[model samples]
Target chain A: MSGAVEIAGVGLHRFGRFDGTSVVDLGLVAVRAALADAGLRRGGFQAAYCGTVYSGVAAGHKVLTALGLTGVPIVNVEAGCASGAAALDLGVGAIRSGRYDCVLVFGMEKMPAGIIRSSFFEPWREEAGLAVTPAYFALRAQRLMRESGVTREMLADVSVKNHRNGVHNPDAMFRKEFSVEQVLSSALVCDPLTLFMMCSPNEGAAAVVLRRGGRGGVEIAASALRSHLPGSVLGEHTPLSGLIDDTAPPPTSLAARAAFEEAGLGPGDLDLCEVQDTDSARELNSYEELGLCGVGEAGPYYAAGHTQMGGALPVNASGGLLSKGEPLGASALGGIVELYRQLRGEAGARQVDGARVGLAHTVGRGANASVVILKR
Target chain B: MSASRPVRDGLFRDCGDGTARLLGARCADCARYHFPRAEVCPYCSCDSCSAADLGPRGRLWLYTAVLRPPPGYRGVVPFGFGVVDLEEGVRIVARLTEGDPARLRSGQPMLLVVEHLHDDDGTRVETYAFAAAEEG
Candidate 1:
């Protein structure tokens, strides 16, 4: 595609909890690093987009002005966990539309310590004890296990793998590994899903610089986002309003299909990937949704170790959201930053060798899903 | 006498006798039902929808027990959250009277009941829930 945009530079302020660091501080670090990496000053960009959920209005404007990079259009985007990817889509769109040659995109968030307070559900639901994010994940896990014969052991294995990989990722919040036995025995957040199996809400920031036409950096072949369809009930906090259609395609599957078609590539052509592993069971479920494996096959697929760093298709090489607690708006952008490092062979100990094409997927509480494909 | 109130009005109505029934919105165009009522049809987006009494009967579809209560929740910690598929083709999310996760099973028959969610300064906030149906 002639309109394909290239990722000129990527930067990240390590994913973790910074007790005293303001959201703007984390964002400034990432933005300056990205601009420096791109060999351009902050004033060179035509526009700016910031992705965040909890941060208040004009978050982008505040972040840009702190660096004296003002007088440009700044748009703030919020799509639950996919906020970062949605903002990246805007940057890519602007560049491809010939509106501007270079655009800056940054995603940052400082989340509260306990369970995520999602206002997406009515207050009654929250009072009824149905608003916990992990509760929905556990419900999906129970159904998937009943349908696929997947065991809790298999789910723990996903955590074991991702956490072990996290040890190599200095940017990951939790850089410690846990055994399968340790995972299954961890604190139970919900039935069949343990505390460590789920990603906690925390702080972090990731930024990327995009250019209309570039020769060196990774090319963004496809950047697609899709929201939940009517009659769809699969999301973090969506109310169960319409008739339940168990067979309807979820937003992630739809977005992935669109990205693959746009990129002229299929799952088999991908060398590695970074997906929304908000929880371990989610990673297994995503294997089916992303076409990495068939339905009811992710359990066996993980047990066989096919998704490790050296496996057939390594996923979450940056240790995933499970290792780096989700910073709502910055979650998806973190995956893209990881993919950029992987494509450039700069992932240090977690590098996936000869990785040419990588895909990043993130789904949010608003029932929005984004899939972006990058090729070296 | 203290008044018994539904958490959200129009969600259900008391028969003035001792029993209450759920209020669902039925679409005249698409023949689908919505729980907790709706102004417009969610399926067909048609305004041809009206409130109807959804008799309290459905089968359990999926469920999980919350180990900890969420903010603003005064219900017992570790309460069961479930979805019951009513005969009207709509799935409603509600708390299960069955607190134990192991006792709950998909496809089990269920019946609705109104219980106290929390006390707001001596005012009992009544909310609807589903329990394992008694065998006939």
Candidate 2:
């Protein structure tokens, strides 16, 4: 295990469509802002990591070149939607290994308009019409609903809650709230999942600066990543290949367990959290996987104000990806940025009270789940 | 007119006696099964995988309908699909022949069919899928 690392700065190019901006431009915007936020001079970093998908080769080098922050060993990472968290994990590893004191990590994406294209499926599967991205989310949603008693109304409530939070987050894409009726009445993308319940693939970027032994910022308590186990199915966007491993633990649970163990804390130790709300149902399922509530308890737990603002363990206080359209690679980092701000008491309007320790989680298409714990 | 072909080779085979079966790989070392075919055992990493016949029946484990067509998919709008928990213990994602997505339920019996997926050139590319079994 490596030593500790601290986030010195965090920045984001607001989550939404940027019609004329290239992915590199979005990345540079976030990177420069993060450097400025950290009060660090350019070209002073030992290395850099860029997380993205569909952004061609050497994405990190391209971004650095635009910023004139070159000459560093820049590496690009792709882990479906968990790309950003994976990059942050790499940065933390570098700092703890005593190889680099300060490192830059940024994630950006500019998905073509429409349903996000996923190359994770085989050609035959694609041809069978089993490759639509949201279709998998809906399948998982139905399974979670049947198993957990999570109602369609509860799924809509997730949209309502997150969108309400989005109104306060100027950086969020959709800053408007809707009633449960409105969300439920929205166009049905798939059974039990509505248009308003799922996030759109748009464009955005978020960047973080990590420095070992840094003072006065959030400490990285733990960063853990786990791939899909042989048999478990939740959070897996990969095509079903063979016999299901019904006995293995879900990747999120495994990642969360490892993170909490490394942090020497439990779910109750968290003050706030930002989870992968790729859809409302996903957030509900994550509640169980992250151990925020006992299995089959998310519906009641969320209804009782446990996840709302000013309530215990408020989740998605930055409106989540549901309100902040997912830009794939940048989605995880966006959640991290929200938590980082909440930990520092810097989040305006939507800040969690007395927030000290926070968790940010994301699960990608490749069945990779990441959990990061931060402490003030 | 052109003859139909399986989307990929080795998915299913015609027994030349008016009967067909889905092709799966069974591990000789561990007795586990895999859908489609496996070159090696995914569980024990052993190279003792061999072809086995999986019948055309299963139970619906989970399902969903795509209201909009995905890129490169030539299927009609509002198509349904799900995982069929085969009797052989392997679950596979397949398009449902059921037109209405609302009526499909979990644990319902399902039957497999090889149907035209799309047309590339003059060939009717056929693929395997599962549908709700007809009530007797």
Candidate 3:
């Protein structure tokens, strides 16, 4: 856009089950850490944007009020799992429009343990067993397998790689690595997708401080958000909308194209990526959607080890949602925080060496897809 | 058997001949079909849509089985569901009578059927589903 916006600081509350911890408290930890990292005192930032899905009304105001950082504009945003990125999109736009110099952006969630539920589907759909999230994933996975020849083993391999990478991330919820066999053998949540292949809905928080001018920090190269086009049907994130149109481009492709164009960079120039792995199949689907690989080529691309930690164009070096667990609101921002560390060469074990550019993507509720690019 | 009723009115109609047809709307402006019957056409933004019956028998686009019950769902666990392409070119998501992945394949001919979903109170709540055409 207009002026360069840099991530001044980034922070996270370890993702996992924090039983008895209030969602507000979980957000407080991440916000305080982010402010302290940015060397900003209370009320130093001009505004705050909070992203959440289940934290209830005025969730951002609640977090800022607890820190006595009220009186400034505090807006809460929701766009399914892309909530945090949506908030960042707003904050970045505000700064580019010369509305504010410095702003605080954070996302937090204490998920109601188990499957994620959304009001996007009609009551009848849920009653007819047509709205189950896992079932949707499985359906997509089955189609992917049919079209792209992606096998169940390839899906399991995705889980294994992410879990292996998650082993090095202290902020990740499940840090232990699992073998492909284990992932395949784990309880089947739905046909073709096993328990370990799916990302758990859990609790966590992540935050970032954004400033107008770059101070040798990671610059926000581009931020783009896109919604599903009508008649995409299976091509979109949400279920039961429109008719079958295989030609319809998914929201991920739309958002990725916009972000790449804004940054004046293509997929070939990226050093790494952090994409939505809400399920293992989603990761593979993202590879094709992000233009990282040709259509129907993700299976062979992963088989070539091009997405592994030390491999070229590593994806999900932060373990993705697979190991980090999806704390809806915080999921997208958490990826940003990871990219911030990698771009700054601060990511210890999971760091992609000499990484200068990175991309973070998240698709929420099958409707909103966001792509954010960062550069050193 | 207890009294039975459709899960929600206007979704599908069961003919006395053990046949069923999905109810939808066809946009008079763009001639596009919408499942569950929308009052307006999403593509053309035209409100001249009229009720249309999507004939039974289409190709199964995709299918899956839910191993666990979704929250607030009163249906049986591990139910089969799929996206079916109707003969009218409109795609619809509905439950399938088949849950076994071994028995299901993409592009298989499917026919609409009205079946029992679950027992709500004392009545057998029914809903629309798709079954293999050969199974019919």
Candidate 4:
């Protein structure tokens, strides 16, 4: 492709929870996998961007220190769930600006099991019992269900559809699926959101090495980032990075529009995609924001099963975060790994045949969105 | 009598006009303003920011009800929080004073009422929160 940043290789440690594994171990395995795939050494990278949600600063140093004096600078990036794409964007920007010939981008996370805490909320608000992310999204979902006439079953349908797709994805967290009745009947995390509707957070890591695009190439056309709608930071810790827990047009749409422009293509031209499927409803909303179809058409698209592996632009063939499990930091990068496989026709049983173009979008805390376009 | 956490808690002031407001900041360089008191002059990066009070009343933009308790927030499941776009053009996130998520709606008008958050070490940590503004 013209004016694109080439993806030399992508590596992923198995996308399962690393409850027993350390973050650096996951990093080494994934980095080795990527390095081997790229036909390069760890020394090949001039700079590195490591993204993680739970792991704080010096995380990149913790990982790179194992590789020895590569002399490459490492920066730790944390953008909630969208950490991978955000870090990749920085690395890609560095390469596109001609500052570095090759940059390595990686995301890894070992989230505290059970409920997570993103410290972008005010202490007072938290005391008022307004800190959990699932609660916030659940509120929105409840409202959307009321306003959109979307049913709990419809939401489950989204999960089932993605889980079915994930059955074909070896890297997904949940390999099996349950009937809509089961999804509806499952235990509730919130009133309408059941265990099935909500994707479980896992421990995982993903890596990609990038250089300038060349012949026989699969390159990054663009990765666009948008600031989330503003929120009260008086006591910031709002989960999901800038939505600030309660107020504005999620800045995600801006990223979608910008990604389209930057890639010199529109959503209609897309062949395949992987988006943040943290929940069934969010994925449906994303189908609209990604411009895959019209507004409020996610129910129809999902009901008609248009997003299946062979449908009009296979969406989330990697089982998405729903089936694959939401590892937050590694979640978006996992999307990249899946897209790369699609473009290379190496997806084997799940490959979208002759896939020439694809996009991967990941959203983070406070409404930060990152869109990455790829072409073979 | 009992110790269940209040949905929200904050100091209240009588406006003498029946109006109470959330605190905020106004920028001197660009006339831009923020709620919860803007610190860094997000508009022009100028160091001049002045504190002021903003409407506790505003339109509900979007909201969520987190069913799970986050790490720091200790409360029962299913908490409602939404973006209240204040009349002053600053949007701040606060717990929907209406503990009932079922009653909340998008674009619905709301007024802020300071309330209690939780008790600290058996003592009240009294902090800022909102209640569904009383309709006139």
List residue ranges in candidate 4 displaced over 4 A.
A1-3, A146-149, A229-249, B1-20, B25-34, B39-68, B75-92, B97-114, B127-136
Ranking by DockQ: 3, 1, 2, 4
Cα lDDT tens digits for candidate 1, A1-376: 4676998888899989899899999998889888988887646999999999989988888889989999989999999889999999999999989899999999999999878777786887777666777777887788778876578988888888888888999999999999989999999888889987888889999999999866767999899999876675545546654565546678889999999999999999999999999998888888888888887787777777789979999989889988988998888999999999899989999999999999999987878899999998
Report the Cα lDDT for residue B39, model 3.
91
What tens-digit string does per-residue lDDT give for candidate 4 at B96-119? Answer: 656555787667878766444456
For every model in order, the fraction of real contacts preserved is 0.73, 0.71, 0.72, 0.37
Per-candidate TM-score, chain A: 0.97, 0.97, 0.97, 0.92
Clashing pairs in model 1, backbone N/Cα/C closer than 3 A? none
TM-score of each: 0.97, 0.96, 0.97, 0.84
Candidate 2 lDDT over A1-376, as tens digits, reads 2477998888899989888889999998889989998887565789998899988899878989977889889999999989999999999999999999999999999997668667777767677676777777888888877878788999999999999999999999999989999999999888889999998888999999999855767899999999876654344755554565467777899999999999999999999999999899999989999999998888788888899998988999999999999998889888888888998888999989899999999997878899999998
Clashes of each: 0, 1, 2, 40
What lDDT score is found at residue A99 in candidate 4? Answer: 88
**Candidate 3 per-residue C-alpha lDDT over A245-333 given as tens digits, one digit per residue, 9 for 90 to 100:** 54778899999999999999999999999999999999999999999999988888888999998899999999999999999999999
Error of 3 at A44 (Å): 1.5
Given candidate 4, what's the lDDT at residue A111?
A: 67
Candidate 3 positional error at A145, Å? 1.1
* Model 4: lDDT of residue A136: 55
